[model samples]
Target: MSENQTIYAAFAEKLDAVLSALEMEGTLPPETNRANVSVEPPRDPSHGDLATNAAMVLAKQAKSNPRALAEQIVEHLQRDPAITSAEIAGPGFINLRLAPHSWIEELSAIAARGDDYGKSAMGAGTTVNIEYVSANPTGPMHMGHCRGAVVGDALASLLEHAGHKVTREYYVNDAGGQVDTLARSVHLRYREALGEDIGEIPEGMYPGDYLVPVGKAAADEFGDRYVSEPEAEWLPLFRAFAVERMMEVIKSDLATLGIQHDLFSSEAALQAAKKPEAAEAWLREHDLVYDGVLEQPKGKTIEDWEPVELPLFRSTKFGDDQDRPIKKSDGKWTYFGADLAYHMQKAEKADALIDIWGADHAGTVKRIKAAVAALSEGQGTSIPFDVKLVQMVQLLRGGEPVKMSKRSGNFVTIADMVDEVGKDVVRFTMLTRKPEAQMDFDFAKVIEASKDNPVFYVQYAHARIRSILRKAAAEDLAPSDANLDLLAEDDLTLIKQAAQFPREVEAAARAREPHRIAFYLYDLAAAFHAFWNLGNDDAAKRIIVAQSAELSEARLFLAEQIGQVIRNGLAILGVEAVEEL
Candidate 1:
């Protein structure tokens, strides 16, 4: 096997060779489907080092009992030098214990590929466009947008590490009514900046002080010229100015969390280019859209409702709850109409598309998916698209719900959270739970130094290893792979835990869940800590011994490799591996 090939990949190839041999010998039928065959670590460590279900999955095609097929597969597997023992367990599950040299070689591989370890080529030759953290350009980024931002950014890094060309995108919703309100609110602040003594902010206008800077900038640029102007005269100028300034603020806030996007597509730009009109024309030609009137809304009295003719898309044809409108009665494009055009624009540049959206947008997922499917089928292109909904994160401090931000006069802002707890703590804590599950972000609990804090636990593990290396250097002892034979069973056990990083990376990338990386790091840290505790009971079990420099050097080599794996995993998650607590 090549030095760069992961241990799991090597074993999987061996398993496939065994199956091919059976086919060639006529013991199993020719060209049997082997898609379901798998090689992975057994759930019970006592079972074996590796296990395969090739016999159980292929038994029917081979026309033999599963246990009988297992015997034949084992007979071929036993011939390999790497396999020390092969045993058949319940229901034809074949378990194989490997020679200790296999793991020792993997430890050497970890040293061979320091920073590049755990990366995979599974996503090669594909381009993925990931749209995330698209908060409306109305105010500063609050905690509401934090979870999706971190998840999307980490997933983008994970995909890139997995060898896909990834494009990070942020959609700017600047052409909405909320921005109009924002303009009106900024006008008041502009008047105040011009010494007009504008009274309390009225209802329906944004109340955040974060917009004051935009207003001050507007006043500085336009002077008293727009102080007494008509709403129609100043609204357009203020709207554009406010949106631009607010996006700047949003970008600064995202930067504090280490997030930056490759592109910022604008809703107003889409409208200005008439993309929605083109989409409607194509849908009409395909009979996917037509002029129609919606049924009266449910739970509304007839007197309280009125039907108006609108252009509707046949979303129900693709399993939506109902046909959705593409245009309002006033002939303006609806949100869905504009969004459909935006997705089509993205599809033009990538092989696959993924949107990281808040859970509140769950209701509109099906219609957008239907539109994309219709577009892909009509255009004769295969584009895989997915919408990952991130559940809400509740902010708390000392077990009580946190209050609103003084600056925003609304929810807590991302800048505030990052300022209070720090970037690493915020990013890592957000990923400790699944994106689809609601979680609490407690200020007091996340930074605690106990093992319960996963971020600290993982960092402490890396820091401890670094401290050991430094101490060993002071004693004139250094790590050396020359005496790897001196490593004991406890040392190899730690190596086994570190070797799982490659498999974890591939699995997490395939599942599109970056939280798996966080979970895996926590487990690896726990195993390292458990092994570190053994040296406290017996002086000979420690990594450094004054009398036995050969054994000490070999164990130091093992420690350094473990630290490297932790750093590689943390890099994929966008968390720094601290060398000191």
Candidate 2:
């Protein structure tokens, strides 16, 4: 495994050096900031290999015309042997073209490092705590958590690849009311398991048949002793039992998607340790909490809305809509208060924090961010925090909506979706679109082996390359000794696309969005597929040349590099790279 930094970063650094030299020579004023200068690939490939806005960004401070400044920067940049040509484009933009050898060397770096070719040290081993799929242990993880799980898992993998010390955590909401309801529901099933007809489960109670096994397990463990037991006696024991069993089911479901968190922090455990109360006291000392009376909500208000003096957090100080209550009128901690405590605990050990939540929790992001800011400030440390609100996925089959689960009355499960298409398809399709966008996962379209399906398309690119490489090796023409210089222009284009993997990975990790990698893989795969078809139209563009063993090896080398990129990308996505379709 190696972080052979991409040529892009290398060029950017070289350009920065050039700017520094110009600064020393007084071509630009002393101590002139070059921070805004950017070196990146041009929008049109025909324009150049790399483009820079150095002159445009710095011309004003230097008191020179943009074009003249660009020319001066170009003079210094062209001296770098790898940069074949640099030209001034509209107004002040500089376009650059690198020697084909630069790309060829980059391909060699990729082939040498294999799957770890694009790994980066962007995070520098910072401890990043990502809380995701903290679903209620009340039942099996369903479609609601499916996207968040995949997204979180991919983000964790991305972070690790970028050299972050990542903690994949699931904040179990065991202390919440939903778990108590689950306990009652399981007790009802326990009676049924003991030969009592409990009839229809009551409204507001989880009525899934999935709880039947929990009930039966309880019955088998400790028979009718609980049958005549009081609610107080059985509630706690059943809640514990049901939560454990449901977590088992949830873990099994996550395994089907190849997801396993490193930690499972329980709210009950946090509360038992007095973290919430401690946080409240800490906030009070910091003057972030106050006793306030709130007005009734507009229009249809909360049923129990009443004027009362309760503990409230100054959430509006951090962009929240209004000051939020930290304690209810009954003198109990609000959910927000407990959540703040949980975040405070997380903040103690983390340099950065991320939470993946369902879209319905969108309104809660601001207050939590505010709480984190307050907590970090009190501790005299800056702990960054962000929340990703994943939108709902509309399940479709043959263009018709597939709504509930047959076996359980709750939502369709992650297990069912994984079982239907496949783990790779499930994970990949969940990320084909941005998390904030509502996407329809159509069963028929996703399973189709066509360009329209990104997973299949990307996987097919790798599979096809593998197939060709195997055939080439059968003829004893390996790519190792081939002169990569013999590759066609389009092959170099494909190589350039592959070389961008490191930059893409770094950007994706920095942005905390793994979907960018998914999108990149799809584009690279499309490029590879298009290059393969070029051989169909023109025999000269084919990988295996009849008379030239050297050229055949060169093409094979290109294919190997492309395949490596696809595999590396899929690895970050937590999806398998199939060798054959």
Candidate 3:
């Protein structure tokens, strides 16, 4: 099927032409704002198959009453070959009832396109860089980082599906005090591995037992070579070793959930390349940074409150609450300063940037957004930057919370979840709801073969379709040369629901909310399920109609198209559409 064959696309273009014809007739003012004009399904299906607000939007500028303009527009729309009838409903809304043949043609197109049906050109090859799950490489990825990981990866896939060139990236935070602590922790384990009884791990160090293997590996590679050395002699060597090993563990965890990043940008490497200093110099020269003392902080009082001059970015000029300190009094760069440099680098490479962060970073969004805006302004380029803050997820079993704490080393890791529930369950369950909302992942419910579980329900819909196909094959009946026009109103309605997949994909990508796709698939599955159940009450409604092979083939084509949509949607969510429940 050609992309332009989509009913919605055809109608939008048709409406555009109607408006142009109106302008030529002098009924509408020339060059009226058509940006707000939209054609979509009416809220009430009984009202119309499609609705448009073109007349209402251009009425004011056209020096005509909305309802009066709508009546004129309806006249032109009625002449279209696809539109069976057009009526002016309520005020200025034009309700259009499309020909049944038009929808039959749409169903045929969906069947012909199959999995590629919903693919859109919305993104238009725009470069979108998504930085997600840049977890500190101090330990294995835990349940806390699960939501962002799945959400980020799903959003990346979603963007690509919507025709964007997406770069799935991970910003490995291999710098600063966190990695240093990890290095020290590994050194303690190394000593223990070398026959030194380092009893308990000290405070402010990782206590997870996963690092014991790292210690053992280090001991095996360099036996007592770094045991007697000074701290400085072993710190860098241990830091590099620990970071690399922890990243390996992290990578394995991500892979278990089908996540792979294109690039892992490092903070230490960014500093080594002098990006922070270069960004700082640019900001200072632009008068966007200056040495200033901020007023007393609000909300919470600082423990050591003292007025000291420090270099600050004028974040307030770009909508932040106050000027943000980019450098501390001790002459060390703050995280925001380094982030500015990182975003600047991203701005140089991509036309758009997106960051998936934990909700704890909600307070920091304004400053980062301001930084991006400043970078874009200074560079004289338009860089679309957005931050998605994913909220926490609570693990549950039958509605009761499962305890997890990363500090105590007893926290649930991503590997733990994947091991318990399959990766498909983990990925699909994580994306069942919006990331901004807190959700509970119930171990009991996700794998259950009931409608209560969304993943199972959706997969069952696809499986149900496959079941029909198998029955048809056993009967030697193929799903071809069938007249799709033979489908009933309910069957055609089901196909209409399937046709919404492309629209939903674009909406999910444009909003940067991959969870919407999950919800859409759930609804589409439910629609298919309801249509399938119709067969239970009436034998004629089933996909494999033994009495009528042509009808069965038509129904099979419809079922397969629904299955294709479900498969495409699951692909975006990084889940497999199971053929068998």
Candidate 4:
């Protein structure tokens, strides 16, 4: 347990004793535990250092007026040495003012823990797998996939900090119809590379010139080897080679943003010619096999729509709107069947699963969850999964939305965005908002060095702390002598803020939202900046030029702790914390 957590626990113990004493005096309920009572800072500082709702929550149960109970509780708490004083205000809130040394001790805790201050073992030894940015292997990643990549990667980091054994995985759709189209697209490029006049790309296929390299590679390997072969003989070899080529480019693009996955599960590998029969047998044994016709979706046009009964999965039994076909009337499995088999494999291998998908897949969440539930025999532990849907990011510049078209081959790739803004700006901007809310990424504002730019604000805080430490060293004060008692007022305020790191990290990790960390770091930086401004007004208040070396050491200790907290928080977001920005 952390020092702050120990302090809270001790406080809870004392509060329980006070409640018991009050009950014996006929002033409150005898059975109140006080265990659920929370000690937190009030948003308004005038209320006091810490406020508790113990009296308020127990008022009706104890059959006493809340304010009266608050007064009695305050009187009991005042006996404790850690609490200097207590006041009751506004309908029974017990506001506490802690001893100055208690705040100093919190600073000592921060100084001791340093960069490892906020790490927690809340997750224990549980294993979790996070799947994200599983974009099809048909082309390079675009801006559409950037946010999910960052969110998933940051979430993985946050979970690791919270002490979980986490695995970051990417599912590659290398066996889908999309890859077939990619093969055809590359075939056109191959002919063009051979000096054949293939004027314009046909409709319903990729038109980007990025695949020209893939075509060249294919020409080098085959050398007209399949020129006279049947489509069945040549198409498989082309599809496999084309997908392999695209994946190389995709990996390079992901690396540009400092993103990497621990595992890449290939769909083709799952449904290989040798493995497909095994999946079919498993589905049959599980009673997921059936023959039923699915109602045509009402709003969208389906080019291959037909009314026919075929092999189906009993998805409706698991809460889907209707049973879905696993195989079409043409005796071939649908994409959903492959996905079902893939999830079954995941369930067999992992304890927990998390999927980060784009918001366009919102309608598919319930069905996927239902399928997993049924597959796991109603034991959610076997296939526990949560889908985090990241809303789209609209690219903008100078306050206007930027537009691009893939058909015209003018679309912006992830590499293009990274090149323009650099990886740090792109990543921090992506994480500044919650995953579920739509965010606008403006090229103009993201690079600006202002408070509005969270990335720079946080990095600047780190740099400022380094500057203070440098000044302390120049004044001949040892950087390591930390007399924590001299830390008071502005210095104490920064230390107390730093102590909130463990709580903040636990909250953010529990919620699976890394944006909370981003916001917390910004607030911490604001507090540091306010303290920095004090140096300009009062020379005595300066951290380095204080009257005694002890005072300087204490202030430098606080400053170094601030830097560590900033570094840890930014590291969780996968952003760099430089000594100088």
- Provide the TM-score for each candidate, comma-separated: 0.98, 0.97, 0.97, 0.88
Top-lDDT candidate index: 1
Better of 1 and 4 by TM-score: 1
Per-residue lDDT, model 1, residue 257, is: 94
Q: For model 1, give the 10-residue run with minimal summed lDDT.
A: 191-200
Write down the TM-score for model 4: 0.88
List model 4 lDDT by residue over 1-581, tens digit each.
Answer: 24635344446667778888988998875676555677767778767677788898888878888998888898889998989889887888888887778777666666667667788888896788899999998888898899999999999999898988888999999876788899888887877777778887899888887888888888888877665567788888899899888889889999998989999999888876534455556656778766667788787467767778877777778888887776657766677777777777777767778889999999888777776777787434556788899999988998998777453286778888888888988888898889999899998999898988888888899999998788777778755534676666777677768767777887888888888998899999999888888989998778776667888777777788788889999888888887886
Ranking by lDDT: 1, 2, 3, 4
Q: Superposing every Cα of model 2 onto the true structure, what RMSD results?
A: 1.8
Please give the lDDT score for candidate 3: 0.88
What lDDT tens digits, residue by residue, belong to model 2 across residues 1-581? 12476888888888888888988988888888888887788999999988999999999998999999999999988888888999999999999999988888888888778978888888898999999999999878799899999999999999999999999999989886788999999999999999999989999888998999999999998799999889999999999899999999999999999999999998889888999889989999999998898768788467766678988899898888899998877766788999999999999889999999999998899999999999898889988998998999998998999979976786899889988899999999998999999999998999998999998999999999999998998999888635888887898999889888888888899889999999999999999989999989888899888778998899988888899999999999999889898
lDDT of 3 by residue, 1-581 (tens): 25446888888888998889999999987887899998888999899788999888888988989999998898888898788899998888999988778777787787677777778889999999999999999888888899999999999999998999999889888888888899999998998888999988888888888888999989997899999899999999899899999999999989999999999999989988999999999999999999899897666467767788988999999999899998878887899988889989888889899999999999999999999999899889879999999999888988898877443377888988888889889999989888899898999989899999998998899998898899888898777635877888888788778877888888888899999999999999999999989889999888787688888888887887788889999999999988876
| Tens digits of per-residue lDDT for model 1, 346-448 | 9989999999999999999999999998888889998999999999999989999999999999889999999998998999999999999999999999999
Clashing pairs in 2: none
Q: How many clashes (backbone N, Cα, C below 3 Å) per candidate?
A: 0, 0, 0, 0
Error of 2 at 20 (Å): 1.9
Ranked by lDDT, the better of candidates 3 and 4 is 3
